[model samples]
Target: MDMSTEDDEDEIESAEEEKEEEKESVEAESEVIDETIILADYMRRFETRRMQELAAKKEKAEEKKKQLRYLIGVEEKRKRDVSVETIITPEDELTVSDRVSTESLVHPCLREIDISESQLKILNPYTVYRVPDDPGLSPAFWLLRERPPIYGTDGVQKFYDMVKRAGIRSIASLKDLLITDQIDLRYYGLESQVMRAICEALMDNTYVRKVDLKDNKLSADACKHLNNLLLRNSMIINLSLSGCQIGASGAEKLYNAISTNATLKTLDLSNCNIGNEGFEYIASALSNNQGLESIDLSNNNLDESCAENLRNLLSYNETLTHLNLFWNSLYSAKTWKTLIKGFEKNETLRSLNLSWNGLGVECLPYLSQLLSRSRSIDKLDLSCNRFTEKDAIRIAKALSTNNTLQELYLGNNPVKAEGALALVHAITPHVSPDNVLHLLDLENVWANKDILHELEAIKMLKPEVKVKLRGILSNYQLVGPDIKKILLKRANYEAMAPKIKRRKRNFGHFVMSLSDKMISQEKFMALIKKFKLKLSKSLINEIMLAFEGPRGTVDQGQLKSFYVKEFSEATVN
Candidate 1:
């Protein structure tokens, strides 16, 4: 039994040992299963994280591509917005040192002005002055506070940016005036504040020499500010205030400023309605001021009352070269006589524009005498006057003696072919150095083919003189259609020369009996009545004009042709 008990205990212990090992193995298997589940979960999480990283990288690449496209589009847009207008002269293309070193005929005053970049920049109307809150600022700022803004206008917000680029730009140059970098503000609708701002900006500018502010209708205050600019600035050579509404008060201010200023060369106050007193003030200032070279007082309501002031100005102002008295009312002989006396005393006047002044035949003799005596006067504009053929003849006689008159403008006058012929003869059949009449403007003058032919012959002879007949109406074309039909009617005369011989010799005698080569219009009319020709007064006048000669006479050859055709047609019928 003891042996059996011990064996049972040993079996039990062995069994217990085997049970403990199985339990331990089961726990180890459970731990392995848990660790495998955790490893699978971690592998799945790692795969998901790799996918998320790839997605993020693709998104980042797309954003970078979109940003690059946006940048390229912005670069293309900038290239289209900036376009510049460039006006380059030969002188402007040269370097400043090269320009200054040349021996050209540039004036000393013009040489003092600065050279530009040789381009025409558009005037920006939006870049306006800022109305500062402080009242103690400059006058330009003070004026801006009182003035109205360019309100309700589009693109007002872009002005500040444009103001930054407004500096260091260029403008067009006046080639004839030898003026470069012109700041043209004509019809810009600039108000007082705007004018003050522009003036302030231009005050320190040394590049611009011409400031054309025509037709702005600026007030007297604006003119005062401009006068202030003139007072301080000396680089400006030409100041055109034409068509401005500045009245007598404004004129007085400018005249007072001009009296003190000496650097300004050309002052244009035309169409300003400067009254008699205003005229006297400016004329008095110009009489003493020596720097002003040209003044245009056209359409200024100047009448006979201002003639004395003009006389004094012409007499005393020695530096004044060009005086434009166009479209005024200095019509009477007395007013012109005073002006003629002034011309007689003045020796410095080079150009005189008296167009549209209603100067009649009475003024022609005095003008003729002035042309005969004045050695300094080279250009004389007498267009739109009452100068007839007789007045033209008298002027032609004076022109033969005058050697200094280079340009004679007799446009819009009634100077006919006879007068034109007389003027051409006064010049010469050939080019002569003594007769320096280079330009003879006879626009709107009616001339027949004979006169045109003679003038062409003279042109071939005297090539130096340019006889301007632009817009010259043909005298033959001026006849009515009915008169043209009557004159152009073809008689059925088959045997032309033989029929004239059979009819005589009587037509030849009649043509000779009237006159040798030409007959007067009255004599032609008398002959038409004597021949019992059925003709109207209009026809008679047209016939005379069509067959007129250089001496205001009808051609006898045309008369003989007409009578022979008439008589031959009568016999044939």
Candidate 2:
């Protein structure tokens, strides 16, 4: 019984082990299925990630294509805009007219007309068109007759038909009316008629900014009509009465008009015989007038007193920027001094033209002082003056101190070698590598070889400074190069020679030697020839012989006789 019980326990143990083994086998199978499911899930995730990446790439490519199209569209638009603004031919310019044709009507959406292809040549865009003889007749018919088609009358007819088909009624469109010199009597000789027409045009509100009555025979009555128009007209900006016979009284009336008119900016009274009285009238207007910016009183009979009045006006007026006082005889140094004194206090005076005036050497010192003090005077014209070397030197010194003065005119001033040298020395202190004197008119200054050398030195020192030496004594016969060299060397020697040497024993002997070695007749003649003098041979020989004696042995009688004889001969000549 004990053996059978032990056998049963062993059998029970074996059955329990088999049951545990089956349970482990079932768990392993479950683990394998779980591993397969995990593998499938990983594969599906990878495929989904790849698909997302492909979709992102396609979207990016599409975006790039869209951007490229946008860029191309922008480029095309820029090209079209550029073509619209660019003027291709003479006829592509803007005209003062409004005429429509069939082609323009076809493109009804286009707001702007392209009349660039049309050929209607007209001079003077400010000219007023005369009213037609018959207002009933269409302006287009006259335009067609005046400007015929080069191809044929049939082409003109076709053009007319095109306009008619476009339903363009009353071709007298203000847009098609161009102000040409031929149509406007104002540009020609009909002064009174032009004045009347201009008045009518002003009444009709035709935009006329400028009225050029230049070189016209407009009398006081005509000017009165124009002045009345100017006083009432709001659009006119420039009134040119150049070369007219507007006397002092007329100028006074014009000045009154300018004072009252708010839109007049440029008033040209050039060559109008407006005397000091007329200038005084203008000066009175200049006190309270804020609209007048430019007044050209050139070629008038304005003297020193007139300029004084003008200067006074400038001192008070701030709006007058450009005052052209050219070709007037207000060039006395005292007068300029007074003007510059006033200018120093006035901050608005910019340009003063004193060209062709006789500002002599005596005037330079005071003028230089005045210029140095005046900070507002920027452009000063002292051209065509009788200024000497000393005068130029003083002026240059003043320029060095006057920082506001930019343009200086010294043309035709007879600035020779000495003057140029002085100017070079004076400007050396103020000039720099960057800031330099811009415009220097040294034309016809009678520059010699020495002056040229100084100019070259100035250029080397201040390479940035533009030095203009146009026509610098090109016609005058300068000293020959070799002769100039000798003369310069002699001058240097003379300068370096001892004025008072140390007193040595036998100084008297040295003086005697110098007297013996004094220049001879032959040497003096050679010097005269070297200087290129045109003295007669006989006169030269005589002068040489008379002055040839040794310093101590000079014959005063012979020298006096020769001088008297030469003087008599010169007087006769």
TM-score of each prediction: 0.51, 0.48
lDDT of 1 by residue, 1-573 (tens): 999999999999999999999999999999999999999999999999999999999999767645533432322112223337755567864654355512123323223323322321214312322444866666768575665344211222223323345542222222222224577778866676655655655555566688898999988789887888788777888999899868888887777668877888999989988878789888988998889899999998888899899999998987889999999888788888899889988888899999998988867767888988989989999999988888888988898888899999998999887787777767775523478888988898765555665567667767777887644444444445544234534211211334345432233334335644777888888886685444457756876787677689988776656655555554333
**CA lDDT for candidate 2:** 0.61
The regions of model 1 sitting more than 4 angstroms off are 1-180, 429-433, 449-457, 470-573
Deviation in angstroms for 89 in model 1? Answer: 97
lDDT of each: 0.72, 0.61
Worst 10 residues of 2 by lDDT: 503-512
Error of 2 at 77 (Å): 84
lDDT of 2 by residue, 1-573 (tens): 999999999999999999999999999999999999999999999999999999999999767645643432322112224556666554543332245544335444221422332321223322423444776557767765776434321122333444455444322322222232111223355455444544544533434566676777677777777777777777667878888868887877676677778788888888888889888887888777878888888888887777678777877887776778777787676677667656666777677777765778756766877667876666778888788787787777776666666667887887775676666555553353222455666666555455566566667776665555654444466555543233323433432355454411221121122223346565555644554344456555544444556653333344434434434442233
Residue 477's lDDT within candidate 2 is 62
| Model 1 quality (TM-score) | 0.51
